[model samples]
Target: MDKLGIYAVPAIIAAIVVFGAVKRIDLFEAFREGAKEGISSLISIAPSLIGLVIAVNMLSASGFFDIAAALLSPVCNAIGFPAELLPLGLIRPVSGSGSFAVLSSVLEKYGPDSIIGKTASVMAGSTETTFYAVAVYYGSVGIRKTRWTIPCALAADLTGMLFAVWTVRLFS
Candidate 1:
């Protein structure tokens, strides 16, 4: 079953080619046209993506996240959350790559087997990069009004982070 799963994608591709042949479709030309469209789409989204990445990087570099993390520590401790996970909680919603960098730093500082490391790993997996998603997806589609997307997504991320900490303690 596991080996069959690995072959599924190839099987699907072969089926698509066979189906196209039976339909007398020019698969190669269609594929080329699709590739060109994809390239054009990339060109459209590139600027927004670059700007989003730059903003995330600026937030990480400004030492502002650290200050915010410090201010949240007392409340975190009261809830049994590890202070070290603060950066991950804050950064996870805005940028996946940024949150990943924070996760890597946490895992390195506290060995991967540590509670903090496990919590960070879980949190990373369970959260989405909300701001980046909105920027790329909405910008690509030309949606101007976000309409409660940011707040809802950030709230979900906060919920995930809290559960991750609690889950780590339950198991460890």
Candidate 2:
């Protein structure tokens, strides 16, 4: 005969619920209170989320991203990455989802085997979501210290980009 204790989990939960109700602790009330607290936090963070969306949209529309890519193209080509992935390097520092979309477009256009597409895929894996960092650091402390952040984050993004292209080209 095979022993079965598989039903014990639900039995234990039932016992706990019974004990709590008998003790006069209202479980539904407690759950509602916790959910209300979570909603309050979401409301508090709403402004920051909206600001992030607007800023990312503006950056994309400005054409500054393309200018950045063009400016960095020479250095990118020198570092063994295809010049086309320069926009990906620019995008990665500004927005994660945006960069992912750009990477997908590149892959679809060129196919993943092409140097540009492969380099972009590698860079996407290697880099951090830089705009999220700024939003978090600024939004948490209310710093608004936008001066030094962009340069520092861009430097880190560039380093990751170079490393990604180099490593991918070397190994693959």
Indicate the residue-level lDDT of 146 in model 2.
92
Q: After TM-score superposition, what is the CA distance of residue 25 in candidate 2 from its true location, in Å?
A: 27
Model 1, TM vs. native: 0.59
Superposed by TM-score, candidate 2 places the C-alpha of residue 42 at a distance from the truth, in angstroms, of: 18
Q: List the pairs of residues colliding in candidate 1.
A: none
What TM-score fits each model? 0.59, 0.52
Candidate whose lDDT is highest: 1
* Model 1 accuracy (lDDT, Cα): 0.81
Show where candidate 1 strays beyond 4 Å.
Answer: 1-71
In model 2, the worst 10-residue window by lDDT is 1-10
Q: Which candidate is the best by TM-score?
A: 1
